[model samples]
Target chain A: MKILVGIKRVVDYNVRVRVLPDGSGVDIDGVKMSINPFDEIALEEALRIKEAGKAAEVIVISCGTDECQQQLRTALAMGADRAIQVKTGSALQPLSTAQALLRVIEREQPGLVILGKQAIDDDNSQTGQMLAALWNRPQATFASKLVFEGEKLTVTREVDAGLETIEVDLPAVVTVDLRLNEPRFVKLPDIMKAKRKPLDVIPLEELGASLASNLDITRYAAPPLRQKGIRVENAAQLVQELKNRGLL
Target chain B: MSKILIVAEHDGHTLNLSTAKCVSCAKAIGGDIDIAVLGQGHDAVGAQAAALAGVSRVLMISAAHLAHPLAANWAPEVLQLAANYTHVIGPSTTMGKDLMPRVAALVGVNQFSDVMEVLSPLSFRRPIYAGNAIIDVKAAEGQKIVMTVRTASWPATGSGGNAVVEQRTAQGTAAGHSRYLALNSAGSERPDLQGASKVVSGGRALGSAEGFALIYRLADKLGAGVGASRAAVDAGYVPSDMQVGQTGKIIAPDLYLAFGISGAIQHITGIKDSRTIVAVNKDAEAPIFEIADIGLVGDLFTVIPEIEALLG
Candidate 1:
């Protein structure tokens, strides 16, 4: 069985994001970019599954501009056998993105597809579920733990109530949560070897998928600020302030 | 002139407060609002939803398959009910996050998640970079709008409505590909993290899994909920459910107490809406002290016990 992992390039999680002064969007000029943290976890899990001899190959796929190739190379270095870049300069909405992935899924016919539960940039945890719905297959989302049992995959999900375990048949989609696994670092030798691996670029239009954003982002702004308050001396002073404000 | 339909979140026994908070968001949009309660033996939950102010009607869908909230099983019923309404809304809780997108996909509409403000009937403001940046978005006209309200941003709707409750049968068969096996939930008698009026959070400074006992004990004394910073949760000091940070649960309590927390920006994002914040850390320069209303430069191990004793 082959495993397909969807990766996305986003601003590094550690970088403090700033909305542009023009109210267009967050400033990404000269800012560091990397594989979305959760997507990295998904790719890591796929590589582990392949390394365990449960899968034959792990294919990494990304949908973005030409610059996304940098992240795909990083995935290749991390241990993905091959990479597919869905070349698109425009920002694709979740549905359009899923539709494009569906076209690839039909052609690739991987036994399993793994994606990040949400992208930190958009914070929209919709792609995996949308892909599952469009594919007309079962989806196990927010998977914290996954175990393969022949054609069946058992996924433990992080739900609002707590952890819930579910079983889905093969040819299913699973969106990974943070606790799945810690991604491994890419060594220098692996980076050199990854440069020799196959990286194919497919244009978004070539996939014959309808790409349209149903939602239009009008403007961007920084969130309302919370003022820093005065520091008190000790617990006694803290209690006094709470009592003064009738919060105790 | 828009009619809204909200899917209620419940555990078959009690209605989750996030549903009322979603109703508050829907009310702000100025609409004829109705709620859909989907689960087996959910009459009590349906009644609870019907009682929330601003609800015009409640459609209670009693189905055995819905006993566990699975997206594939719930999406069909929601899509069927969504035909009559112009907007569909749900709480951005785990269940809603898992289920709403599927409903939107089936209805062929894009879902707006974590909606913090309703700018217009179709426009909304939502936090994008984990609450660091806010974006104003508008759904295209001539399409049904699907959205999930960020519960922390909206107040819970009051209980004064007298809406009628209607019973409805499940429309489609359960998607048989996936099956619910089990749920290992952390059973706690303390108030829920999101609904708690006061929260006491611990950080990595509390070294081990056994170290969380101090936080729990202090929370019990104050009648507050126990929370943990992402560092503490990652260090295996507590369950992931107790984590309060950008990637964890966002909470807006009346008072927030931090013990040995350095207050990373990700963690502070969750508590920015909190009314009052108090930090107790040995390091005087910890970032948590920056936003703290009262900062105590002391060890949590020594300060917590003293505060507990004083309260007693």
Candidate 2:
């Protein structure tokens, strides 16, 4: 069994994103880029699965410009055996990205496919399920815990209500959530070795995935800022202020 | 005018409030709104959904496989009904986040997520970058639209109407190797955190699980919902469901009170939609004060008890 995981290059979660002045998109020219945090968790889980000898290999894949390979190398440094990049020039939406992944799944036929629940940059939270739907496979999303049992997997999912546990067969999609496991730090030697690892680049068109989008992101703007409030001396003053506003 | 179909969220018994909120969002678009309630023996849930105002009809789709809201089993049911409506919508809760995208993929359309504002039936404003930036999304004409309504942005539609309920059986059995296990719901007596109008949240400053009880006491006294920062939940002080943040539950309450929470950007995104935010932290430099409608630089231990005494 081989584990396939997604590695997306996104604006680091720590950066305070700034919208472009032209209402086109965010300004990412000089921004620090890194692996989507949830994808890092997915890669960490895939690595653990391979290390346990339950899986024969771990393959990390990404789609986008040439820059995406940088993040794939980072995944390789973190212990992915190989990397694949779906080279595409246009910014891919969830629909196109899922379609591209389906093309890959048909060719690779990995037993388990893992991806981040969402990318912080888009915050869409749609790609994994979309991929599963297109691939006609069961999806276990927002998984906090994964237990392998022969052909079936028992996954603990973090939901709005609480923790929900479910079971799914192999040849499925699992989108990891936070609290899965801490990602390992890449060693200097591993970074040097990752350069020699097999990194395959496939054009989006060669895979027969369309790059069209029916939904257009027309404009971008900053969110309204919250006005700062005044300070109070103690709890007494706070209570009085709340009473004045009729909030208490 | 748009014809909208909302996939209802329920747990066998009561309907999740998110369904009603989706009704509110659909009303903004001025549509012939219908709800699809999928569960076995969920007549009660159907009746509850029928009670929401502005709902034209309720589609009761019952099957043994759909008793649990697994996306794989439920997506096909929604797809069967997809061709009848221009828009297929659901709440942006975990269930909808997991289910709607699959429906979109089956429909071959990109989902419009977290629709904060409706420009037209075809165009919407949604948040990206964890609410730091907003983008206007427009769907092409003649294309089916799949969307997840951000419930926090819209108030629940008032219930008084009597919409007609139409019953139907599930189309196909998709018991394809996936099985439902158990749901450890945070069966707390506290008001449902996402639906509550008043929220009281604490942070890592509460050193132990016992220290976190102060938040519960205050919440109970004020009849508010209790929440915690990721720091508190990660520290094992509270359940993860109690976490309020971009990753957790994004909430909009009438009033929000924070105790000792430093307010990371992720946490702020969850509560920034709140009507009135008040923060109390002993450290004067806590970032929570930046967005708070009222700020108090004081010890939460002292101020909490003091406020409780004053309330009494």
Candidate 3:
């Protein structure tokens, strides 16, 4: 069995974001970027599954520009056999990205595909399910627990309502949640070796993937600042203010 | 004037909390909200949706097969419904996350998922870095707009007024690729974390999974649901089912009680909207105190049992 883990390079989670001077997008002049935290969880899970002797090879795939090679290399250093980079300077929208992935899935026919439930930058949790829909495969998204027995994969999904366990056959897509596995740090020795590992670069055109842009942004703005709240000195003052404000 | 469609998500009976919340959001955007309820015996569902404070009409598509929400099966209906409506709105649940993108792509517009607030008919506010920052963007160049509303900020209204129901058939059950194999529900017998009015959350200080039982007992006594800080869940002290943090579930309960939670910024973002917050942690400097309405600087092990015994 083969495992394909998807990764993305995104702005560091801790950095506070600023709108660009152009009012068109986020200001990225000097911001640091790292592999999305969730995507790291996905790669970590793939490595663990392989370490447990459940799979033969682990392949890390990412769709971004030259900078994203660093993310793929990070995955490779963490024990992936190889990586595929679909070089597109600008980011591909979810659907087109799914199309590009489907092309790769068709070519490699990996037994399983794992990805983070959502990207932190876009906060769009649609890609995994969208890719599953495109591939016509069963998806166990927001998977917190994954137990593989024979040909069946039982996964526990973390939902707003609580946890839901579902079982799916192989050749399925599963999106990793935070609890799936704690990601391991890349050893310095492995990082050095990863510099020489097989890193294949493919273009969207080679996969015959459509790069159509769907949504257009007119402008970017900040949310309205919340009004300064008045602090009451005591419970009586609080109740009095509540009554005065007609909220009592 | 373009007709705006709101997809009604229900449990085959009462509407999902976020659906009503989305309705309020849609109304804020200035639209004639037409609700689409697809499932068996949906007349009542449609009527109930129409009764929401801002709903104008109900478009009912009732069928036994449509009862289970399969995104593969519902996208085409959403697409067909989109043909008649100018904008589409739904709660950003698993179903909407699965269904909306396909519906948007079918019409060549990218759907916006996880919108926090609508600034205008065309612009919206959404979190960019896992609740760390907010970005407001304006959608351009399409008559059709689709967005999913984050569930926490909006309150559910059961306000039912008379609304006209328009019967329509879906473009046949969307059958092609995916198949529903099996579903195993987590029978927690507790209100969903996102919808619970009161949440009793434990942190890593709880020590182990056995420790969570104490928190659960207190939650049970208060008729509240159990939640966990990310550290606790990561430490395997509690099931992922109870995780409440930025990467996990976002909740806005009426009263939130944090037991032993040290309170990371990520965790605070999840429950900051609770009306009244109570924090009980031995660590006096825990960040949970910043937003807490009441702070008890004490050990949770001693405080929780006492609270439970008192409530009992």
Residue pair clashes in candidate 2: none
lDDT of 2 at A226: 81
lDDT string for model 2 (A9-108, tens) is: 9999889999999888999888899999999999999999989888999999999999999999999999999999999898889989898888998889
Kindly report which residue pairs in candidate 1 clash with one another: none
Rank ordering of all candidates by DockQ, starting from the highest:
2, 1, 3
After superposition, candidate 3 runs with Cα above 4 Å error: A13-32, A48-56, A146-154, A167-171, A204-248, B40-47, B62-65, B174-191, B213-223, B302-312
Error of 1 at A56 (Å): 0.7
DockQ of 3: 0.32
Lowest summed lDDT over 10 consecutive residues: which window, candidate 1 chain A?
Answer: A208-217
Candidate 3 pairs with clashing backbones: B51-B161
Q: Kindly report the fnat of each predicted structure, to 2 decimals.
A: 0.78, 0.88, 0.31
How far is A211's C-alpha from truth in model 2 (Å)? 2.5
**lDDT for model 1:** 0.90
The docking category that best describes candidate 2 is high
Better of 1 and 2 by lDDT: 2
Highest lDDT: give the candidate number: 2
Tens-digit per-residue lDDT, B24-114, candidate 2? 8898878799999999998999999999998999999988899999999999999999989999999999999999999999988999999
Global lDDT of each model? 0.90, 0.93, 0.77
lDDT of 3 by residue, A1-248 (tens): 99998998888877767766666777777788888888899988888889999999999999988889988898899899999999887678787888889899998999999999888787877777677767867677888888898877888777655566666778888888877778999999999999999999998788876755455555566434323334334334433443464433
TM-score of 2: 0.99
lDDT, residue A17, candidate 3: 70
- Regions more than 4 Å wrong, model 2: none
